[model samples]
Target: MIRMENVVKRYNELIALDHFSFAAKEGEIIGLLGPNGCGKTTAINCMLSLLTFDKGEIEIFGQQVHPNNNAVKSRIGIVPQELAIFDKLNVYENIDFYCGLYVTDRKKRKALVEEAIEFVDLGKYRKFVPKKLSGGLKRRLNIACGIAHKPALLFMDEPTVAVDAQSRNFILEGIRKMKAQGTTIIYTTHYLEEAEQLCDRMVIMDSGRNIASGTVHELQNTISTQERIEVGFITEDQTIEAQLEELPHVVKVTKRNGNYLIHFEKQENNLPDLIKFMESRGMSYTELSSERSTLSDIFLELTGKELRD
Candidate 1:
């Protein structure tokens, strides 16, 4: 439904998007992930024609993206990271105003606005102005406004940021419902777990480039550490870490919270080999757990673990 190729955007002496390329199919949730200053927002702005790029092409719904392309703009919706509601407008009026941008017919727009209120569970606050609602409620109203017209493609940037757990879950479930109804959503968030749970595929960006793009399992397979086993032994020996390192396929071992976290390369017998080696030495353990590499691990491995501004 969307395609961008070798996009280049520069600002004075700095480059915001350097040969970045990405694509999204219909009815899929694509996660756009990156550290700060990585050009995620820049790329989105270029696609939305909010910002023009120096090079490359961006197409949405099989047509070139432009600011004045009302046909394309009418079929798209944007829920930005910040709340876009007016403080003076009530919930129903806020949603109605945004929906009216695309839906001109008063009767159809009114029904769509009511549906949006119920979809976001904002019926109770339909008459409440932005100042009277809580943070989570305000977020719900923001979502309702953007989605009231039922656009085919939606760009949701950190829709759940700083909201309570209940509201977050509600928003996520509502997103799933949108997907079920054939809406393609481009999702962005700082919460890795949320992206892992919600996105069908992800595109990781760094230094204004598309570093990696794939499903979660595909990304996991690209990293070196395939599995991690955390073990806490009741009997402590000074050489226990070194001894465990001798096991087959062992990459490295690090201490984490009074436990030894053993990193291992891909192997089917990692756990069983460790268990047999411990049995031979008569070593007993207090706690033992095994898990595959997670999205956080993949992210850190791809992007250096240094702080980003």
Candidate 2:
């Protein structure tokens, strides 16, 4: 439903996007992962024609995207990283105003506005203004405004930021419902767990380029690091930690919370073999848990563990 071919954007001398190419298929929630100055937002803005690109082509629904494509744009919904709402307007009014952009008839527009409010579970505060709502409620209001028109394509940039856990779940669930209804989505998020839980496929971006793109498992396998096994034995043996460090494929071993946490590298998960070895060595564990590499793990591994400016 959306495509960018060899797109490039520059701010005077600094390049934001350089020969970047990406696509979002219908009914797919593709996570756009990256750090600051990585050109994620620049890439999205170019696709939407919100910012001009220096090179390459952008198309949505098979039509070239330009600044004044009203017919094409009306079919898109955008919930930006920042809140976009009128403080003076009540919750219902904010939704109505955005919905009015697409639906001209007051009768149809009113129904869509009501549905948007219900979609985000904001019916209780329909008449209340922005100042009276809590952080979560404001986030919900921001969502209702963008999606009231029932667009075919949605762009959600950090939509769950700063909301309560309950509200975050509600918003995430709503995204699933939209995907079920066959709307294409381009989701950008800092929360890796949410991306792991929701995205059908993902793209890990950095340095203004497409560094990685694939399914969760596909991306995880790209890293040499695999399963992390933490073994907690009923009997505390100081020798156990030293013995585990001697095991094959063991790269790092650390003790925490009265347990041995072992990290393995370049090994097809040998947790079962480790268990057998521990049994033969008389090291019995009361609790054993293995955690597979998550998007966060891959992210830090690929992007480095430094704070983004």
Candidate 3:
């Protein structure tokens, strides 16, 4: 439903997007992930025509994106990272105002506004203003306003950020319902687990370029450490780390809360190999656990562990 190719955006001496390319199909939640200053926001702004690029093309719903393209803009909804509701407006009025931007008919807009309020479960607080609501409630109201018009494509930038767990779940479930009803959502968040859970596929960006794009499983295959085993030995030995490194497919081993967290390359026999090696050495483990690499692992491996401002 959306396509951006080789987009390059420059601001004076700084290049925000460097040959960045991204695509999203209809009815899919595409997670746009990156650390701070990675150009994720720039890419989104370029696609939304909020920012102009030096090169490349952006198309939504098979038409070129332009700031004044009301047809395309009307079909798009933006839930920014920051709350976009007026503090003076009550919940119902806030929703109605945003929905009225696209749906001019008062009857249809009113119905859509009510649906949005119900969708976010803010019926009881329909008359409450933004400042009167809690953080989570305000977030729900934010989501309701953006979605009141029911655009075909939605750009949700950190919709679940800083909200309580309950509200986050409610928003996520509502997003699922939207997807079920055929809304193409472009989701951006600092929360990797949320992205892993909600996104159908992900596009990983760094330094303004599309470094990786695929399903979680596909992205996992591209990284070196596919599996991690946390083994705690009953008998501690200083040489255990060196011995564990000798095992096949062993990438590296690090200490984690007194347990030896072993990183292994892509292999099925990692756990079995560790058990056999420990048995031969007469070593006993007090605790043992195995887990596949997570989205955070893939992200860190691709983006590095350095702090980003």
Q: Per-residue CA lDDT of candidate 3, range 95-153, in tens?
A: 99899888999999989999999999999999998999999999999999899888999
CA error at residue 46 for candidate 3, angstroms: 1.2
- Candidate lDDT scores, in order, read 0.91, 0.86, 0.90
> Model 3: which ten-residue window has the lowest total lDDT?
300-309
Tens digit of per-residue lDDT, candidate 2, span 183-298: 88999876778888999998888777887889999998888677778888888776887899888988778777878878887546478879988999988788888878778778
C-alpha lDDT of residue 266 in model 1: 88
Most TM-score-accurate candidate: 1
Q: Between 1 and 3, whose lDDT is larger? A: 1
For model 3, what is the error of residue 206's alpha carbon versus the real structure, in angstroms, after optimal superposition?
1.8
Error at 127, model 3, angstroms: 1.4
Report the Cα lDDT for candidate 1.
Answer: 0.91
- Alpha-carbon deviation at 188 in model 2, angstroms: 0.8
lDDT of 1 by residue, 57-140 (tens): 999998998899888999999998889999889999999999999999999999999999999998888999999998999999
Which is the leading candidate under lDDT?
Answer: 1
Model 3 lDDT on a 0 to 1 scale = 0.90
Clashing pairs in 3: none
